[model samples]
Target: MNSQTELAALLCSRLCHDMLSPVGALSNGLELLADEDDPEMRKRCIELLEQSAAISTNKLKFFRLAFGAAGGFGDNVPVEEAQEVINALAAGNSRIELNWAVEEQSLPKPAVKVLLNLAQIGIDALVRGGTLDIGAEKRDGNVEIVTRARGGKIAFDETIGKALQGEIAPVEITSRTAAAHMIALLADEMGGGLQYALSDDALVLGAVLPQPEGMIG
Candidate 1:
């Protein structure tokens, strides 16, 4: 399969995998509520349905910005929007603490994608729930993004690392590596590269994208 087609399939697969749990919960809750006669149990079912719907909505918002073309015709996205989606995603897991250090009012679409994707990866790495530190800035005519996951236990995926560095063959890319692969492609196209450092307690991902002329004020 061609790289673009494969990438699309992989991303779709990843989205499906993420959405199944919450969507399924919603369905199950509806089923139970339909057959229940107890008011208390019906209330509990409705509450679960609400939670599942919220989770599904949050995921959709995050994927829309991170993986899909959002912001309409604008070439830049407000940093505050990115922060909101990331915060919503992290809210699902209360144990994760997010630190936003991005001072730029907005970032190029490509840079925003990298920032959001890296933040997602960082959140995943914090298996035991810890701090997710995200920062982005403009320096030396380039947009720099850094995301760090710090926890007592870090689940570092070697395949993802390889994907970020363009070490994986196109035919081998899977749903798990699709985001990283896209990030690598974006960095390369923008005259930059992806970097990462992995240890027992932390996983740090960084990217630098050359800012387009007239993009900065």
Candidate 2:
């Protein structure tokens, strides 16, 4: 298979693998709650069950839009939906603040995936509590998505950056690195490129994706 097709399959598998644990835990929690005799324990289990279910559902929805093919979506997805997806992913994670600056433009599926992956990377970079600024702008006939993670001692791991450059060997495409590499590959496929820089307790990931003819309308 071609590289893009291979990458698509790999990404799908990676997403499923990443989600399985939380979803399974949610299922188990429900079962435990159903079987528990103690009212207090059952109540606590129910709460856990609810939280787990919500996390699984939200992550699944966000992944569908971000990595998988968003069902019934037109050539360009609505900006509101994208924002909602990000918000869902960020639920209960107050350490990272998401700031969106996207125009009311519909982005192609690939472009959306690239943006989401970059957002995920930015979120990961801010392990020590920080602000994640996500913005999209149209410039010179291309759509550019920029993600900045600001925090104390921010560092972008070298392995991830290398994977983003398409130098990741198959064996090195572990779950930890797959998302970032996928974003870079998507940017390359769109006839654009990715740029990354580290500045003053912040790491920035920027990708420019080519806009298809008549896609915005």
lDDT top scorer: 1
Q: How many backbone clashes does candidate 1 have?
A: 0
Candidate 1 least-lDDT 10 residues: 1-10
* Candidate lDDT values, in order: 0.91, 0.78
Candidate 2, superposed: residue stretches over 4 Å from native: 1-9, 153-155
Q: Estimate, for each residue in 58-137, the C-alpha lDDT of model 1 and write its tens digit.
A: 99998999989895357999999999999999998999999999888899999999999999999999888999999999
TM, every model: 0.97, 0.86
Give model 2's TM-score versus the native structure.
0.86
Ten contiguous residues with the weakest lDDT in model 2: 1-10
Residue 28 in candidate 1, Cα distance off native in Å: 0.4
